[model samples]
Target: MLFDLPDDAVLYTALLARDAAWEGRAYVGVTSTGVFCRMTCPARKPKRENCRFHETVAGCLEAGFRPCRRCHPLACGSGAEPSVAPLVAALEADPARRWSEDDVVARGFDPSTVRRAFKRQFGITFLEMARLRRLRESAGVLAKGGKVIEAQLDAGYDSPAAFRAAFAKLLGQAPAKFAEDALLRADWIDTPLGAMVAVSDRSALHLLEFSDRPALPSSLRHLLKASKGSLGLGRYAPTDQVEAELGAFFAGQNATFRTPLALEGSEFTRTVWQALVAIPAGETRAYADIAREIGRPSAVRAVARANGANRIALVVPCHRVIGSDGALTGYGGGLWRKRNLIELERGYARA
Candidate 1:
């Protein structure tokens, strides 16, 4: 739906008019000010060329745009301030509100100071956090077998078409066609590395990957097909367990993940995955080393494929693998995250 949006001049016109029809449909990220706002925002309009319209707050945040203060572009309907737990609760209750910095100021808080504090504490601005909350709410609704309409409405999209487009943009699938009756539940976990999506059931963790991983859509498709459409969005026991363990792991309290994992892979791939798990938290391994460990010394490519196929990210430790040349190779989560993980682990190892 983002691509279907009107031309820049038309969109800028809508923003200038503060069109309520465009509410929940278009967000404008101003290049000059590095701020994004809903079309309905009451703030002074920026120049036409300064505006970059996005379909979702996530896009704005990813593009480095802070939420507008006057219009409260990130505010849930509750108008909660970012300084308290009420803000999170408000987001959970209605994640789609365009919260603005003025909402914070209305609650006797300083917008710039709150932004700085939130970034320091959460490693992301309040708008990004609210965006994630909205996404999680939609995912949870869908996971519970709610209709596409329900999920769309809950996600704050007034237009079905716009909602479908946003859903597709985020999850790479049309909402109506998304799988249901999932044997595994999908939930989001936040970390300094951004947001990670984890799918699991009561017993074992099935899949975990950074939300931005390119392979995420295909992986979800494969899992849904393999499990016969039994992958919905919600939390399972394994999800809770992994979230806690991951927090500790990232905090350097412990690197061990004892969460049970239900790996779905070929025998060889499973072997490779097991080898990856065997890699110590503060250590690195090479593809050839993994192949050798799996008794497939000549299957370097296959081993690499197996490693790439791993569904559980941190728990499986795929980031621990490096190229034989000592270069950080491909990681589904991104090489930057891999590098950080390695650095974090190595530091912990020394400590």
Candidate 2:
């Protein structure tokens, strides 16, 4: 494949010299066999007319090439992309199966290693990701007011306890306790950056934190406990509103979010969050600015602390607050992503 990125230098070199780098990133699709093999495919290269190169295995599949058996083109993680192809393929292959540790083991993989790899790519372990997929499907069926038994059967749960356990572990509540049409609910949403856990109650949103944001688990737990377990699914109106607005915001489109937010903080902290949101889509502010906005000029440190405690990400706009003296500071999403986000926003503003 003619990958133009400089990072593909090694792959090109490998391809030119018949070296090893081409083993994964580039695949050879054989016309006669209608199967694609990895660069390291042991089969002799077909005539020039019979071979086509693709940058990704998915691309090859789209080009109508089924995987070749000898090369095991779908084998997970031996590629440059870190092998999400296998896990995804496995899921697509057996979406209805109750994937387990034994399933992981039977695939000739160390569950932890596979877990970490999938988590790195999909932001959840294979089992957990599968569980979430199952939950979403089941939840959708139940959202239409399907019977609990039908939802349980559709999710591949042989027993009520197992289904409840998976649902609780992922959704933080038992399936039976799920409100069929609650005003608010919490759910997991995947984005290009990472996995986010969003919570909403019927007229307002309460939480939206990334899973890898370090303080997410505690922040969510605290909110859940304080709200006395009113949080249900993240599929409510507020979540849809926030998700769409966020998509627009990320796309550099001008869209205002008007959803009600359930801020879980004292008066000062709420004021700080309000200032944070007021920083605007593409602009930023210092902790001192937030403090001043809250009419507590001397509480800059407290403002920073409150900013750090923010559970809602882009909505609360905590990432828009930078260090004093124009430096980027502590962000739960990691400083690098924070910088990138600010840069992205700055570009949006300038354009």
lDDT of 2 at 120: 57
TM-score computed on alpha carbons, candidate 1: 0.62
- Residue by residue across 1-351, what tens digits does model 1's lDDT show? 234565567878898898888886778887667667889887888987466676665556554455676776655232333474455445545557646677667767777877776565434576657655556557667766788888777777668887787676666567776545557667666554556788887899888888878888888777777777666667889898998898677556788899999988778788788888888878898999988888878999998888888878999999998999999998888886788788778756797
Against the true structure, what is each candidate's TM-score?
0.62, 0.62
- Please report, as a residue range, the 10-residue window in candidate 2 with the lowest summed lDDT: 1-10
Whole-structure CA lDDT of model 1: 0.73
How high is the CA lDDT of each candidate model? Answer: 0.73, 0.67
**Model 2 C-alpha lDDT per residue in residues 1-351, reported as the tens digit of each score:** 223222233433454456565555576666566676777766665655455556555445434455676776656353433445666677767766788989878867888888787655434466865665466567656656677788888788888888877666655566677655554676654433444677887678888876456676566567667766555553777887886676556444653677789888888888888887778667888988877777789998888888888888878888888777998888887886687578657756787
Task: Count backbone clashes in candidate 2.
Answer: 11
